[model samples]
Target chain A: MNFIDFIQAITEYDFLQKALVTSVMVGIICGVIGCFIILRGMSLMGDAISHAVLPGVAISYLLGINFFIGAVATGLLTALGIGFVSQNSRIKNDTAIGILFTSAFALGIILISFLRSSSDLYHILFGNVLAVRPSDMWMTLVIGIIVLGAIYLFYKELLVTSFDPTMAAAYGLSTRLVHYLLMTMLTLVTVASLQTVGIILVVAMLITPAATAYLLTNRLSRMIFLSAGFGTLSSIIGLYFSFTYNLSSGASIVLVATALFALVFIFSPRHGLLRKWKSPKKELTT
Target chain B: MYAVEVEGLSVSYFETTALEQLSARFTMGQLVGIIGPNGAGKSTFIKAIMGLIPSEATTITLLGLSAKEARTRVAYVPQRSTIDWDFPIRVLDAVLIGCYPKLGLFKRPRKQHRQLAMSCLERVGMQDYANRQIGELSGGQQQRVFLARALAQEAELLLLDEPFVGVDAGSERVIIDLLRTLRDEGKTIVVVHHDLSKAADYFDTLLLLNRRMIAVGSPADVLHAKTIEGAYGNPLAFLQKVEVSS
Candidate 1:
């Protein structure tokens, strides 16, 4: 289908409109939160939390409850568990994340296998944005508002904590509290993106656009703005491609983000590789 | 009022004790230096006092208040190496972080706060570098930026850990002069220093520490050869340098 055909479909179908709006919101929020995650060097934690929520989603499905409740619960539990193990023992944080997320993901797979109604299981692993329910769209909207509001109200705390924990602590800001709050926000964003990008690829949405913006700017505020723009653009274009080509919506979105990252990686004026390669001596001097 | 007061303070890692049963007092309007050799728990002592690390202390007071209660009233400049310079923050913004404690939660820095931060940067001679990314500055410039940040706090007590290490000579002079001026203004200043040769010249009171307080008194009293030898556990060449300088 052409651009006109896609626009026509968006206008004609209610589910199409919901999918568009939900994906765009997910894109924007993920981009904003991803800036902090990448800046804190917590990209791996983002991936881990996204995957760990799978068990919660599966359990929620089995219990016939809202997936949002269960997903957030398990996501927070895994985040706290990782923090506890890493802090209380000799094991490093990355190792703890690796061990816990895989276990949680495996448990989710096992639990999902037992349920006779397996049609939704595939959609859980790989998102089906076309099938986004009205409730799921509203849930995404709420999560977006809360996440964005929390960030706005607590930007200073988050900035100081992310930049220098010792300074934050010295000034009576609780770095641990800020960390747990970010983790909670991350889990919420992950759950919101579940129907849009799926559990397996939500982290990409959380990391790629932010990283792309990171390469282009040296200011946190600008980086966040740019990342959100990139994410939104990617979602709109990815949705268009998915509709036209009959492709996986989640994969298409992630690929569009990746493509943007690649472009920025090669062509960003200040930090791009092409600039360095073109003038190696000048780059070294600077 | 005393600037700092501690009794029976002990700090330890999992299996190793960093400092033990340390007791000391610092008066307001005095410049104090914590002098020790490597592994002498100097940084740990600062962290414990700042409530950045866990410790056991029978009594720890700052500016006549409990350590935790007085945190907002104290400004700290940690070791230069402790921060990630590569963070995406401008020099001015980094200094503006000092205004955060006073701004409280959910409140952004107003024009007055920004002006205060800028004036602090001007005091440290970093006004021109305000727009530069933190990583783009020299080590001395970065140190000055941190000092500017500490200055922006506008606190009664200032705690600095090894502010002179890796610093250029000019920056060192600028920092020491700034610190002395702050001290003269009735602010209590505490610095963790390792350079014994400069100890006598820099501090009004010297604290020689080696897992414990070996001496805490005037520089002339604490820089004695025996006191230096005891704290370092050896006759460091700096001991001879310090003796000759004294």
Candidate 2:
């Protein structure tokens, strides 16, 4: 369809409208906080929390509650449990996250099958942004505001804690508090985005912009803003592409972020592969 | 008054006692050096005092408060092992982490904070490298960055874990001068030091520990052959022979 036709279709169709707005909000949330996760080497934490929420949502659905609430609950429990368990179990953070996530996912699969709502589970995994109701949209916005505020109120702490928790702890900043808070935010953001982007694609949104921005900047503040901007831009462009090609908008947004990352990885002036690969003579001459 | 006081402090790994009932006190304006055999709780003593390790109650305290409460007043310059130097932050940014507790969240650094951090860097002779990524710096340069960070903290007490390892003599001289200057400014500095030869030259007090407090007093008294032998649990003759033969 043409641009005018596409705009008309988005305006006329509730599903398209929901997808667009939710995508932007998710973009903003993921973009800012993704920088935190990437800096802390907790990209896998996002994956872990997402899968861990499955069992909660499945059980809640079996009991007939709000799927999002169940997800948020499950995600927080898993995140906090992993946080405390990792400390006592002698397993590395990522390894603990891996173990917890897989178990939660397995339990979720079993529960969903038992509940006779595996199709709904499929929606949570692959997502159906088109089906987001007005209330769910509101929930996504609330979580977005929360994610944004948490990042803002805790920016300095998050920056230091993410890069060096030991120093943050030494500064009396309660590095553990910041860690748990970030996990809680991740829980909310993952649950909010689950309806629009699915579990697998959430990792892409949460990681791509930050990873791309890391290649281009050394300053933490710059990385956060640039990642957010890149995330929004990629979401919009990807939405347009998906609309035109009749593809999955969620996957399209992820692809756009991936494509941007590839470009930045090559062309970013600060630490780009090409820039680093330049010979010493070439650099000196330039 | 003691700037730092540790009593019956102990730390351990799964099967190792890094520190055992180690106790010491650091007074204001005192430069103290800690020397012991490897795995003899040199770094662990510092970590326990900094509350970086899980320790028993009443183990470590600073300025009469618990370590957590007094953390801001007690700056830590951790060993190179504790930092991932490959992180993509500039020297200035890394140094500025020292002032993070003061800055808190939701606020960026102001001119005063930057000035303090830059001044710290200047004291370490690394003012020009404020914008350079930390990973690009040499070992000495990295140590300077940590020194800059400690200086930026403006703490009453500074705890360092191996501040002189891998640094050249020139950088080492600069660090020693800075430490002396900080002491003159009425700060207490405790360093987990190697190099037994420089003990007298660098510090006013010496703490010789081998998983316990072997000696604690003026370097002249604590650096005696008997004290060294006691701390190492070996004869001074053997140590001297090893030193000369090397």
Model 1 chain A scores worst on lDDT over the 10 consecutive residues at A277-286
Measured with C-alpha atoms, the lDDT of residue A273 in candidate 1 is 95
* Tens digit of per-residue lDDT, candidate 1, span B114-166: 89999999999999999999988878889999999999999999999999888
Model 2, A90-190: lDDT tens per residue? 88888888888898889988888888666776778877777888888899898999889878887778877776777777777777788889888888888
Candidate No. with top lDDT: 1
Model 2 regions more than 4 Å off:
A1-14, A280-286, B57-59, B104-108, B233-246
Ten-residue region with minimum lDDT total, candidate 2 chain B: B237-246
lDDT per residue for candidate 2 within B51-162, as digits (tens), equals 7778764556688778878877888887776676656688998998888877766678888899999999998999999998887777888899999998888888888889
User: What is the C-alpha local distance difference test score of candidate 1?
Assistant: 0.91
Q: What are the per-model C-alpha RMSD values against the true structure?
A: 2.1, 3.3
